[model samples]
Target: MSTAPLSAPRPSPPMPRRTGRLFALTGAVVGVIYGYDTGSISGALVFLSKDFDLTETEKGLVNSILVFGSILGALIGGKLADALGRRAAMLIVACSYAVFVALSAVAPNVEVLDAVRFLLGVAIGISIVAAPLYVAESTPARIRGASVAAYQVATVVGIVLTYFVNWGLSGGGHWRWMLGLSAIPAALVVIPLLRLPDTPRWYVLKGRTERAVEVMAATDPDADPHAEVAAVRAALTEESGGSVRSLLRKPYARAAVFVVGLGFFCQITGINAVTYYSPQIFEEMGFTGNGQNFLLPSFVELASLVAAVLAILIIDRLGRRVVLLTGIGTMAVMLAVLTVVFSAGKLHGATTWVGFAAILLFTAAFNFGFGSLIWVYASEAFPAQLRSTGASVMLTADLVANLVIAQFFPSLMAKAGAAATFAGLGVLALCALAFAAVTAPETKGRQLEEIQDYWSNGGRWPTAPEPGPVGAGPLGGSAASPASPS
Candidate 1:
């Protein structure tokens, strides 16, 4: 055997490029739909509370229960997506949530609202798991970051659009329409799901080698599909990838803890509270008066969108750890300031302007690192076999944390008052800062193959600086076939 191999075997073929862009676009649309739903409830809750005679606490829970379902859904959704094709599972969830979104409009009371929200949360959970993973797996290494950022851009766009929709529909009775409208986008996702091809990586895992090539061609029509398929097959063979069990193994468990823990911190830093209740938080900032004051708070969404764009641009350049640290650090300071501003019980004319400005700044900081990187980091932090499950576990925590904050925000605001409520958020932000400083690794510009060994090495930045793609070799370098084309 050794005597036969003095020279290398024939190189694999090349791949088409169209397949990558198509998959990336699909991811962007899914991101938009998910993001839209995340904020849609913010404006709809007011009307919903009235229609169902919900108490303040009930209304908050109604808003958050869906996120709780989303948590569990994220955990389970990943396993499902991995085991049963990301496309298939995402499509199923898409249909389920679209129906439920419409059904939510007819909910008889808070009880039904909770159920609908929970189901919808499940849908969003699935979207979270499938969308990011799809972009990461499907895109060419050259454009993976940009592709994933497109998803982020879509999410922010969805949020901004939701705010505008909320503003347009604002009143005592527009909540039903708000909740129901999510289905429209869900329906739209169906068209793409039907047309967009499945992931080639997933196909290879299923042993559909020929089909994987076909998908590779569709996704990257300009490149050599067979070569791409062969490279993917080689990568998969070497990866030793599979279901969720590998995630719990000792080696992976270490990385899983860091990634998931950071994810948890990302969720509980009071960002969701601000997103869900900016209008209310602003009111407490002593900017009372229903008309323009209420509308003014909505502008924070614009800040959030801007922050995401900035983060996308800088993430690869600045490195993940520093960005996370900076975001967490800034958020901590702002939350503390907000706490003082609220606790003091005095609102100068400038206080209102400063208050809204600070809130927007806070939104910016949160989005800059924690918001955008959470999805990207989560998707990349794990080995391929356990990628979905591990991400799901983390996102479940995220969504549940979202629920904890959202479910009790109004009550917390009522009981502790604004100062304490915001102070709590400040404390959480501090913890995130500490977490980032201690545990988070710089992942900017690293390739997936180089990423796996990162866990084995305890996430130390390599000193040798052997750069091929971005990070180390096992998961980093791109494989091109020489047999077919240049």
Candidate 2:
């Protein structure tokens, strides 16, 4: 309840540098577990379906059940992160992952496996919210994009690695091994997290100024920690509270709409459909055998991994809006080509290669833009006080869109065929592109406090007033170039 102005100078402490990177890297490891859990099922489904004698609907349920759980997890994730702290919430999620993956491996029946995977989804759900938020809060604005993109990079790595694992075990159809080995990575995440402090922003929110300054000094060596703390406090002072309903009012409302829309479009444009059902799609396109199915998707995933790395390299330099618009536009074009190829009838000979190339390019384009930037945007969009609450809302919208695709994609493909499916997704890609063009803000190197100010100032990215003492001006004095028109 202390509302003391941050203008008073605080004691500065010498803390180690690059600790912020450690936090980002640790969050990326969690992304690895998330990716593994998501991709493992893609290869495992073929064998698991045979063993369980699952119908198409049942298979879709098994795939989507995890997303359903994630929706629940995401709904509560904001409160959990806010109350328990990001590091503690992640610890809980990591433990849940280990337990659920183990249960999933030993599940004696399909029903049990579904139940366990749903529980696993809850863990994944919380992670998607916590991991990026942690990285965003802990790292400096200079490398924030790359640092957060590391999570996406790690995600692609996990997917590619899981695909390889699936191919290795496919000879004997060892789906259990594919699903359970992720627990090892999940267990490893606890180590760095145990040593890492909660984000300075979180500390400031709780009114622990001394600790917040200490952590900020360590994480952002270039900035005056006292200034940063003052800015965060200034921004928080302007906000009423971090309630969900508050997001629907004034300055925050536009942000809420943009973030939720971004989250929904990020999923609904058919990335998960390809991710979850690549093998089946390939099989329908005339690829035969588990080896071909799994091997082919591995190549596609590898392209995504390469593109994710590219995102890390260029996101800060090129800015979020350019990457989002260009990547989404490319995806629409690729989907259009895919729709045409599939409509030519079941792929064979030359058309098969064309379809493969289209899918590969589509996946790569997606990873470059939507996959990497989604986290950055989600993490940076809201005021620090409402960061978790806003993220939870966006993530819930995201998972709901994901659930719809995962639950219905199989049936959609079966009833309408690949041509129509690709066509529908292509239209969505177009919509997402237009949405980004209109609404996405360029948050290239702006500090978190500056971003909060952008919302408060009626959507204009605030330019810094004349420089004063390091932390003198309102909202922590730092020169900032105006953002490009959103």
Candidate 3:
């Protein structure tokens, strides 16, 4: 492939400026499907239980089966993305999402539905890992946090939108429609996936530097394509093969611990408990009316979404450590307050309002920090070579935590009541906060390759490392620009 002359004065035509935003927006469809799948199920569960006469164990099974499938998806999907490329893996996920979800909608019995949900689970799992990885690879470091967090924002959009869908379908066993409607967005996302280019990073990895440069120029015209291409080549040169064994060693192993911890805590923060079964939670809080149950949780999720938007705006400025610590601290406090309020016994009037406010605060705080940060952190943590596989390691941890919680939460509620369940989670939240304080690094404006050095140092970088070949330019590393031809 011909290279751009290093000192050439030739003017290159500008690519469309809107490319980055459009790509990020398209990638967020994965988040929408994730939100819809998770958020919609809670509402549907209420009606589904009635239809199937499901026992508590069966109910938990139904809720957790998707997560179980997700675990498998993340494990395999990460490798799939690395091997087949991000765009292709996403295509597979999108098609699977449309097919399985549609199958789920028409399932004739609980056994059929559960089996289908598990299949659908695989698609959702892959979508979550591949989408953020794509967005991270495609955007510049300056806005990487916000761009990837766009997935989380899209998740909130899905959750908030699905709440309304649930409300509309809440009548007399229309749960099938709620479960199936998700395919529309899945189909919509597939349209863009069909047209989108594979990430430049992936292109570079495949030694298709010419194509990589083309993608970069289109995405960010201001970038010096030759410098960016050289940086990517250098980074790839330093990297080893992305074998699973490699990821399990020394620096990568230690990094995996941090990623896994973050993923595990992200789920155990009680966010899912509220999101997945908010109606039931409201009922426990003494709001037995259907409107209060559904409407309040929807509003809570809206608050959560708004908080995520705020995170996106300030994440680049505040840095990951500060924002993450502050958010976790706030969440821990709020969860404690929730435990206290709920423990004060089920009540009416002002107390109920207090409970609602507490729930809102907890949800908001979680979305502010962990919701967006988890994806940002996970997507950026690994070296480029193992990016997708490393993401799977963490994502698998997340889904494992999710599966266990989903399967046992209802029984935990039945056994110990909501207050105790929340109190325990609050304790876990404090532990998460402690973990962040001890190990989290500042990765606000660093290139993806540069960020890996943090883990290389065992998560203690008292000062920033020197700029390396991966992003050694005025604009910093292989940025959004494409390479110019010689």
Cα lDDT tens digits, model 3, 373-455, are 99998889877788888888888888888877887788888889878988999999999999988767778888787766555
**What are the per-model C-alpha RMSD values against the true structure?**
6.9, 3.8, 6.2
Candidate 2 vs 3: which has more TM-score: 2
Candidate ranking under TM-score, highest first, comes to 2, 3, 1
Off by over 4 Å in 1: 1-17, 217-235, 238-245, 461-486
TM-score for predicted model 1 compared with the true structure: 0.86
lDDT of 1 by residue, 253-346 (tens): 7777777788788878888887688666766666666534346645777777887887777766766776677777888888887877776676
Give the distance in Å from residue 220's predicted Cα in candidate 2 to where it truly belongs: 1.8
Question: Residue 473 in candidate 3 has what lDDT?
Answer: 34
Residue 371 of model 2: what lDDT?
A: 95
Instruction: Give the per-residue lDDT digits (tens) of candidate 2, residues 301-383.
Output: 99999988988889999888887888899999999999999989867899999999999999999999999998998899987
Question: Cα lDDT for residue 262, model 3?
Answer: 93
